[model samples]
Target: MQQRRDKDWDLSIGPDTVRLFILKAKAISAGVNEDYEDGAEHEVEFDGDARDNHHHDGLAEEETEDLTARELRELIGDLNVDEAAELVALAWVGRGDYDASEWQDAVAEARQRGNRRTAKYLLGMPMLGDWLEEGLEVLGA
Candidate 1:
């Protein structure tokens, strides 16, 4: 019998980002898990996004669009909790779409999911990180 993969994992993202990430994770999980208990737990201001309307009704739809990896990184700038979590989910399937840029956010996000250590190390190229870092700034991520 195969062992079932556990979904929740522990991770770090600089102390400054940890709390923000936790809130984002909560909001995304709440949105994705329809049966999620305590509906009030995930509520936030939900306004101030340009993609959304004055009432914030369009925020959900705006997040549904796929962005390039480079776009994704720059997009994460000052993202609220829900947006950040959603972006991390997108990164898992974001290969080929990502420019060399987006290294830091990619690595930080991958670490957040606890999957990067094994997966990233196994890629066999030591310079992937360097390329990602340099390219992220160059690509304007």
Candidate 2:
């Protein structure tokens, strides 16, 4: 087993919670490119064209993705203002917007830009999971 890194700084949000967000974010990212129907089954009348009869796979996976997204949204929504801001700062750091040594400035900026739509903003990011993981690693958390 690999040795765990030591955490030398204080974080408003716990590492385990960040890991959970990373997991859910990765699931959402993976599902984004998959072909899933809009929860509808259609009977196509083909006019000698095979393209018209094309159907998407993974309805079950779509449902799971929906649930995971909802869970992630709720998790982010449930965090207090400080925790949410810290999370955003962590992402910014991970994305190379700021260095780990400038954590306090990042967190302050995040708090200044804090809003009720933190979850929505974060979920819209394509590499949220990877960024968050990188942030944690950089912080040695």
Candidate 3:
């Protein structure tokens, strides 16, 4: 992998940070689907008192929102403009929107289109973490 060009662009965010972000994104995406055996492995019977006390769903929507999603929001919110743009560019590159040879172009576009809802935009991507990881690999960071 080739190192990112220092003369053309100065990426303030490090690879480690991107890696961590990708990890969190992956976690959140994976958590979207909870797969568990329905009495396939083990079975337990509950009495009336037990059933009455524990009659809640697996996880509420609000509870799911608080996990990796909130963490990702905070992470994106804390990033500066340049860092945020770089992240967007990385995602773009990873998603094949821009090739590694067009890294500068991707970064430039990211900066131009950056907004307050970067976290939301990023979260909307189905393979965000994979894309980001690919971008980092392309950048050789």
Candidate 4:
């Protein structure tokens, strides 16, 4: 892959937008994991075991689609196709799936993957915030 030589990485999306996304991702991550703070138990029901005791992994439905999730979704929903693709690429970079050296490749891959469910896809990642931040740092943005 050809190296991106300049300090100005040609991201279709702005760094401020990426930073905002980072903030929301961080909030969502924190909110989802918040319930487990004091050993708060969440109940999970299993099939064919109505009588059996339920175990909680703190991934309750409410937690999954909480205010943070909604806000994150809204934020993602507002992004255009190009921006969404860039966001995905950044997340992948942060996750160690791709290095900054392969930034263009990562972005191309993200573009090919489609951006229809970016919010859901990103929200599903447990470390979305950290990954995006890492990607930003790698890009020197």
Global CA lDDT computed for model 1: 0.36
**Candidate 2, poorest ten consecutive residues by summed lDDT:** 34-43
lDDT for each candidate structure = 0.36, 0.85, 0.79, 0.79
| TM-score per candidate | 0.22, 0.78, 0.75, 0.74
Show where candidate 4 strays beyond 4 Å: 1-8, 41-65
Pairs of colliding residues, candidate 3: none
- Can you write out model 2's per-residue Cα lDDT over 69-139, one digit (the tens) per residue? 99999999999999999999889888888887788899999899875999999998889999999888888
TM-score of 3: 0.75
Ranking by TM-score: 2, 3, 4, 1
RMSD of each: 17.0, 5.6, 5.0, 6.8
lDDT of 3 by residue, 53-122 (tens): 4454556754875677888889998999888989999999888888777888888898898758889889
List pairs with backbone clashes in candidate 2: none
Considering TM-score, which of the candidate structures 1 and 3 is the better prediction for this target? Answer: 3
Worst 10 residues of 4 by lDDT: 1-10
Point out the higher-scoring one by lDDT: 1 or 3.
3
**What residue pairs are clashing in model 1?**
24-81, 101-135, 101-136
Tell me the spans in candidate 2 whose CA falls farther than 4 Å from its real position.
1-8, 34-58
Order of models, best lDDT first: 2, 3, 4, 1
